[model samples]
Target: MATIREIRRRIRSIQSTAKITRAMEMIAASKMRRAQERDIASRPYADLMRQVLAGLAAQRQGDDDIHPLLVQRPVNRIILIHITPDRGLCGGLNANVNRMAVSFVLEQSVPVTIVAVGRKGRDFMVRYGREVRAEFTHLGDRPSVVDILPIARVVTDDYSAGLADGVYLCYAEFVTTMTQRPVIWRLLPVEPATIEARLEVGYIYEPSAASVLAELLPRFVEMQLYHAILESIASEQSARMVAMRAATDNANELIEDLT
Candidate 1:
């Protein structure tokens, strides 16, 4: 057992930690609210974009009429865009994403490249000796779509240039304040099954159909990347808020027991 003076010092240290955790909890909560709202509000537009892309696929003809974005190819070289927090203190958020990403890489038969969207993801992959083709970090509490363009461009350009056969995104999906699930979403060679429900017929294009798709397909991809980043950030803040709240409570309990 510690002496009275030692116990008192320990209590003071815990109290200070509790104070910091509480502040972080409140800050994360505030940002989580905004991030969550933005994530939700953007869903409708995202859904519409998917619908349009599906409709374009429905318009597919012979090899000449198909858009390259919708063209399916064998998966040999793969790229995963992993999203995580720039900072720590969010319990298992980065760990969970990194685990899933590494699991994915391990399961693949060919070379896998990672496009890291935050410091944690980049650092983790680098430490494991995996290739990181592109990386973005220090995006702050909130980041706009413009900030995500380079990330989107890097992967899309690689896919277009045939440097990669498949593209994926790994991130945590915000289900609720206390629940976030890590998932892998394929971004390239768009899955027909996912958008089949939204497919429709009989739509005339203003310019040539191919011309219209050339303009819209890239934007569609960029939007999806932006949405993923937003979701990841929101989930990070939510997880951080919950973790901090728990830490504060645990500190309080410890202080009480010591007394």
Candidate 2:
């Protein structure tokens, strides 16, 4: 037993919080729609790019001169690009991605460094005593492919220069408004998806296959990274919207219970 005044005060505070969360839910819903559109729209192009890369990789199977990015060497040092949300109200989005990255790093025998793409991942990795090679944050709700080039350049330069042997990308993949999956995908050594020989169509490269590969490999890395970031954004917005909606509903339920 509580007095009438104390119960009234508690209800007021909860009502205020509910109002704020409702507003956030609306904002997140708006942003989620845009992010989902961008993420979905880019998937077809990414798939086609992978198919093209697979064909080019097949063409240079026996050649002595393979692109440096496509050369798979012994993994002595590994780089992980960990992407997460900067803010935390998105349920388990940050925790799920961070947990996946930590598990990956622990499982690797070689030295694993991180190129953190958001504040949450960077802070968690730094706190976990993992080596952070680079940090990128505040990329905003919508980012262009050009915005991701520097990140791609850093990893590509490191791999080409032998500073890193393998690169992995960790992010949340948006499936539906209620679902997001944490994924750790390989980014370096340029492993193109396997294609059947019968399905391959022979196309003439403008200059040479090697030359085309040289141009496309870096672009491929950039596109993959850009798409992953977009997926993470959409996932973050969806998770936040759902989380806030839950909070608002819980608050209302509590109010009714108290009354």
Candidate 3:
């Protein structure tokens, strides 16, 4: 029911939108490559750290000798660390993660606290009336280990002090440049079985087993949190790139249909 002139004007508007999305897609693609590099580069160190800690845990005599980081406790207070993009135009990445966080809060039996590492998640949790214990953002596309330490410390300290019973980290796991899946991973109360599954066994420790664990266990925890941030950023960029391409495609299709 629209005139040809009106349709042509609409097409011009869509074309402009398509150009913006195209530019965004290119920028996101560039960032995604850098992020993937960082993720790949750090993976080996993290894996080796896990193996060393697992071997040390195995060397110990009894259950009580296990590191405090590996202890599982009753669910009294739950802490969720959510990693999301500070900005939008990333398709459903932010929405998907926030939905999971809200669902977790509603489903938990004990007190639930959210530690949001991105602005998007923080705003959503606060608007939805979910308890946000802590928030960090403005880390930019490329973040270093020191940037996320504050967030990691809060959960680690709470778990160590017996203030929080469990800790969960929510982020998107990278599959491919075009496909990313949101994942909820258990961060604290590291299970021996899980570690042992991937663990390389029968390694001699240089120092006392106790000393090795005392030092390495904390590093493993920090590395896990750091890598998680990388994964989140990569996934966000990938999702954004894919989404923008789709938008541009849809716009082009509409232009053709109108013509």
Q: Cα lDDT of all candidates, in order?
A: 0.86, 0.91, 0.86
Q: Model 1, 1-259: lDDT tens per residue? A: 7899999999999999999999999999999988878777888887877787677655654546566677778887999999988999999988998999999999999999999989999999999999999889998777877888888889888888888999999998888899889999799966645774454556788876677777778888888888888888889999999999999999999999999
What is the Cα-based TM-score of model 1? 0.92
Regions of model 2 farther than 4 Å from truth: 1-3, 193-201
For candidate 3, the per-residue lDDT at 82 reads 85
Model 1 error, position 85 (Å): 1.0
- What overall lDDT, based on C-alpha atoms, would model 2 receive against the true structure? 0.91
Candidate achieving higher lDDT, 2 or 3: 2
Model 2 Cα shift for residue 71 (angstroms): 0.1
CA RMSD of all predictions: 2.0, 1.9, 2.4
Q: Report the poorest 10 consecutive residues by lDDT, candidate 2.
A: 192-201
Model 1, CA-based lDDT: 0.86
lDDT of 2 by residue, 75-121 (tens): 99999999998899999999999999999999999999999999999
lDDT by residue (1-259, candidate 3, tens digit) is 9998999899899999999999999999999999989888988888788777767777673756767777777888999998888999888888888888788778888988999899999999889888888899999998887777788789989898998989999888888887788788798887756774365356666677788887887777888998888999999999999999999999899989988
Clashes of each: 0, 0, 0
In model 1, the Cα lDDT at residue 196 comes to 47
